[model samples]
Target: MPIWGWPMTEILFFFEVVLAGLLAGTMYSLVALGFVLIYKASATFNFAQGAMVFFAVLSFVGFMELGLPFVLAFLVTILLMIAVGYATERLVIEPLTGQSEDTMLMATIGLAFVLQGLAQAVWGVEVRRLDLGIPDFPIPWLADNLGIFVSALDVTAGVVAGVLIIVLSLLFRFTKMGLGLRAVADDPGAAASIGIPLKNIMLLVWSTAGIVALVTGMMWGARAGVQFALVDLALKALPVLIIGGFSSIPGAIVGGLIIGVVEKTLEVYVGPYFGGGIEGWAPYVLAILFLLWRPEGLFGEKIIRRV
Candidate 1:
């Protein structure tokens, strides 16, 4: 039998895992970013964001299947996402108007189911391949007896995610609209008093979240194909968000990376020793511990609510 020590193959696997984690973190960041954005603006969890990602990915791929070129298909999909966002804000969120935050959260939960059903009905519940136009070449550089390898797709995912993160940072820094978004997120009441249109701002926040969803869909769909994976992914993102603090963008990204790394490592080394795999519960375990030790997370603002 081979020695139990960490072999070259194992070392290579770890590298790939780290690379994959970075990419996965980006997608998770997008999901967590949705929470931050909506919570910053409306103080609601906006749980439907995951379903939004699922629908956006499925819709984009579906349009592509209908013979539209990549750019056209994406444009159409983005428009639909914008409409979905506006409709959610107008119909569900607006009608509840002034209700307790729990009420709005419940509304989003309902909206999540509605979106899920729509995705299944429209996409036939089958996994559809998404053409993200990334070159799917194998990384043969790590060859020989070691034969350490990673897919081009994983690299592309990391690059795309990095690009999106940089773009978001720039947008929030340079653009007038982004400035408005930050102001609203920081203080919606003050923003309104200063002439930022609340309605347009809300629409813009949701649409931006949706666009982030599109990038998420493209990257993940490129991996597992587009389907109900969005739901599963949303569940995965919860712990990341919990540990990262719900409002900080960098926290979300960092939380995703931590979850990805810890879960993968635990599954590899500690999982089989106990039973089969422990990846499923790793994040929750870490989240709970973090909560106990530091309830505010690594980057969360400590808001002291006096009794």
Candidate 2:
């Protein structure tokens, strides 16, 4: 019998659901960041990003299974991802320079299949657990005091995502390389004319995207187990990218939070009417609505076509 007409426990539970959704959305933003970096730099959609995530985590788990220490394995995986990025830029993207966007996209799609096959060949198709030593249980003080349950791992993820977004924002806003990247993204021909080195910038962008994929893979793998199905997680980022704008990092973060909150709230409050599973499709539905109304997204620049 609360003054608001809802039970105190129910109100606490609603807040808990929203918090959980926000945390989950952070991970979604991490994945979308990879797509944003590549698209911002090269205007390439990078269809293979999901496969890259799958490969990165599978490779890390395989390395760990080979008796490598956790830290060593992580370092090794970073190096491996960097190498993969370099190879992709040189072999797949460079060859198709100046080609139609469809051609470049097709190349990445092919690369995705190649990476997926290579990972399965090397590590097999078995699902594997990735224990990062973060506890997944609820925080004691919050549960005891406020009756709100939240996972320590989710909190850690939110913090990690926040730090990453801040670092990237600084990197893109304050550094010489950031300026060069912005120039290249705006017009590669002009950037190259001014000695910006388009190839090198693209290489750096792809490399950074690979590192992002690795981080995303680790977080998702730790939560859901490392498996081929992890590739599908990238699909979840599509709605985020659409809502946040594919070229905006901060937009990605905000879009993720919106999706997360809506998904969780709908699943809890409105799911019973539909017999549950509302969370699975709710984000996409919202994304579609955004597409119809705001195709450029909240922070995206509006395209101006000159006749």
Candidate 3:
């Protein structure tokens, strides 16, 4: 009954906790993916990313409450996000195009508050349920065979996250538009010189980021409910990005899984030793430690400068 100097039950419990953490990490990666997309296509930090998650889920659930079917509600939410992106590009990003980075950062912070207030005003401050038809029950087969308990909801989210990452990778690799996005990310001036419309490209990038926000919102909302707290869930993505790399999609996935697993496992195992509540600060501490070692992140490019 002993395994690796630990009881078999203890080992099984550890595996179960790790599995749960991996699933939760997918949600973090989904949120961080939005930040990566926006920051990659444009140099903006997108302080509004988390707010967008709150708004998107609120809108989707609101639409569902109005008798719209899930599919219809989802499509409508997409269109709304596209409009939000266009308005953002036109009214915020474009006007401040040549401004300092600090100026853009402030604008996004303002946008975040604006979005949070607007969503509350429109949808009310009450929490709402979001059902994507993914059950909250554990899969009996997995639990019975492997002594691991995993939520069906978490499994669905993980699959969706994986599919999205793969689809995005293919899009960036094979599409002309995707190539243009890469060019803009590399050098906006050079891309503009080659006849790629910088304005249009930026718009495309924002809208795409909007889509990412929507996906993050749906997953987080399903797990935590459609509410203000979902906005805070976006903060988890920051550490994930710090661990992975700001501009690398693969980094987002890996970093998110790491944060998710580490935080959850620490909370369950080591939390009591620290008087509980270790989940909140554990990821940040880990990220800070990793950053001290490598500022650019695990998948991010190395910065080399000659003085």
Candidate 4:
């Protein structure tokens, strides 16, 4: 019962694959949340989110290169990302107010290019290492006792993503700003009528998305190195959005984990039989299948229009 010349059918190996998939899925959900947050607030897709990940990582790495400590670089990068969010809201979103969603989305596409150019201009297109103080080695006890191959980096990333999800869940459930965001998502005009401050809410959402992008960049960059390719990883979020729904946070999380598990399992167990390289298409196929079953996604609400 050897698969791909390896004993992957073993129960321990199955658990190992599941753990790896979960970690990968957490990273995907981290990126996918950027889309969910923005779409929920403004009803416009932020195509620039992936670009923002690159910019944040590049900026953070640049700061680190300037002799700043990791904590200082990270905090400064967050402030700068917030500033970028504010600028994007004022310069791109504000002027495009009242425009169609298509127009606003186009603006975001342009913003993506602008951000990419800025990163290249400032960071000189060099792929730089991003060390977030996480060790790259695996835990010896887990590896030896459980026969599970887990990277410490993956564990660190999973813990960070879990903490982030908890913090955001708390913020959304217990904060006035979160209330405003929910109100805006329900109905912007109604939210505005109730003094929810639509503009401010949008700004806050964008800032929050920017922060998510920063964290995504740090974790992914620490794993893959900071470079333009990081933006490609961001594209994986699109399938996540499709599978999870455009506006559901929990959907993003669930969809990400599903995608991660499906793709990893396919690559590890099935790809060998099919000549390999199934990781890229497997998630999309899984998403298409899910859509056929539930068009609105696992946690997404179905809309019923009045005829």
Candidate 5:
């Protein structure tokens, strides 16, 4: 098939695929950030991050349905996330104080299962319309008298994502609280000895991760409507973690972009020949390929252990 023969709409569809891949990467950054934060603080990889994102989004949507204004609803949801974070540390993490990294990781997996059940129980196993005041109608563009359109939703998603990355970078770079967080991540034992309040910093990271998850959920919910469907997006983030390295912020964002673009492009261009499952597994395939070449990931820190 000649590329020049395609309809204008088809070309616009290609643009949308690229935008979605980039946006998916941004979303993956947020999810992978949650994993990295928890991992950095306690050396435990939290497998429940996807569930956490879905759960936070559900909370935001559910709270808005109770008639609260968006600002108020968002604040309440953040506070709720803080409480959840504290509980996660005190209850789930605290009891396993002296466990190995593998043990803690397994515990987080259990937490993931528990969170999945909690989402079903709280949301009643049904999909809900979760609009958060974002309108998504697109305007049309013309080329050769053919229409190519860009969606208001896609524009908003991208802008929201860019703004979020900038804001997070600022938060982690300029604030006193942010400095405390870095100290904690770099060396908790040293941080504790120096009055950095190590446990408090861990709680803050979890709460911050929760807040990021809330935004992710709202953005995603706007596109697909909130439901248990969020778990699918969360699952897509795992391969992102592998490619980005377990502890790198830049890694998360870049890995996500790579996965998103490759997966979307393949699904559009090559999926028909492979029974149409490209969208579901292509990211994993890409991650495995990345892993084989650089086991530490592109941005992962290289730690030297002495015997």
Candidate 6:
């Protein structure tokens, strides 16, 4: 026991847990980023993002199995996702332009099932391992010098996610295309009135979202072997989006961190009392509380309507 009435070792362990949780939260943020991108551009909740993640990584694994080099496989997968994006815009969204939100949402729900089945048919229902060449073990120096353990893979993930967020932020903040995207996100009719190409912008946004899905899939598949269950990971992101807000990128990142920290801490300290699965559902409970307290989320914009 120390001056704080807790063991020094316990305090160190608590810090370690928090660091690990924040790192893990980056993965959740990556997934939520996909949702934010699409929602920002189209104001539609893309229910098929998880399926896109599953298909992208599954395709990457399949290509590798067929003797493609790692880099080649990744390039091919990116191309495929781009094509998927194109097809989605041309075949699905184009035909249903001006549809109600519920209709578009139902379309995405159907799209999810279709993508899942298509991936299954093409890649088969076998779980495959993805190795990104990053070691998943603890950094020996940290453990030896500071008595805290952190995974190299989690660190790599955090760095990748941070870089991605920065790049996206830059793209949205300082580019001609970014201006067009922002204009469309704000109001499609007004954007088109100013000569912005709505269809082209939507295509670009969806394609970018597909690319985001690919990055998300690669990270997640590397951690938890590629399988159908990975689709459920999207459900985990729902809590993240709800807590963070469906349309705010920063909200996604912060919400994911909060969920990760809360889940890990609760699972560690309070789990033993409740039989140990608190991590699975605690974030959702927190999300519900957020819904009750701040329906638009911490960073979400409140909508105003005149009757």
| Per-candidate local distance difference test | 0.79, 0.88, 0.89, 0.87, 0.78, 0.89
TM-score of each: 0.89, 0.96, 0.96, 0.93, 0.88, 0.97
Superior by TM-score: candidate 1 or candidate 6: 6
Evaluate model 4: give its lDDT. Answer: 0.87
Q: Ten-residue segment with the worst summed lDDT in candidate 4?
A: 3-12
Model 4 CA deviation exceeding 4 Å by range: 1-9, 305-307
Deviation (Å) of 165 in candidate 5: 1.9
> Mind giving the per-residue lDDT tens digits that candidate 6 earns over 77-196?
999998999899898887987898899999999999999999999889989999999888899999899998998888888888888888888998899988999899889889999999
Candidate 2 lDDT, 112-216, residue by residue in tens: 999999999999999999999997889999889978888888888888888888988899899998889999888888899989988788878888888888888
In model 5, pairs of residues that clash are none
How far in Å is the alpha carbon of 301 misplaced in model 1? 1.9
After TM-score superposition, what is the CA distance of residue 24 in candidate 6 from its true location, in Å? 1.3
Question: What RMSD value applies to candidate 1?
Answer: 2.9
Candidates sorted by TM-score, descending order?
6, 3, 2, 4, 1, 5
Candidate 5: 10-residue stretch with minimal lDDT:
141-150
Q: What is the C-alpha RMSD of each candidate to the true structure, in Å?
A: 2.9, 1.4, 1.4, 2.6, 3.0, 1.3
Better of 1 and 3 by lDDT: 3
The residue ranges of model 6 lying beyond 4 angstroms of the native Cα positions read 1-3
**Candidate 2 residue 27 C-alpha distance from true site, Å:** 1.0
Please provide, for model 1 over 1-307, each residue's C-alpha lDDT reduced to its tens digit, 9 standing for 90 to 100.
2246878666777776676666666667767776777776676788888898898999898888889999999999999999999998899877886787788888999999998899889877888877666756566674444465556777776667667777776777798987888787667778889899888978988898899888887878887788897778777788888888877677888898888878877776778899956877788989999899888777878856667
lDDT of 3 by residue, 112-158 (tens): 99988999999999998887888787899988898788889999889
Tell me the deviation in Å of residue 108 in model 1: 1.1
Name the lDDT value of residue 233 in candidate 2: 71
Order of quality (lDDT): 3, 6, 2, 4, 1, 5
Our tally of clashes for model 2 stands at 0
> Tens digits of per-residue lDDT for model 5 on 231-269?
877888889888988877777778878887888789878
What's the true lDDT of residue 34 in model 6?
90
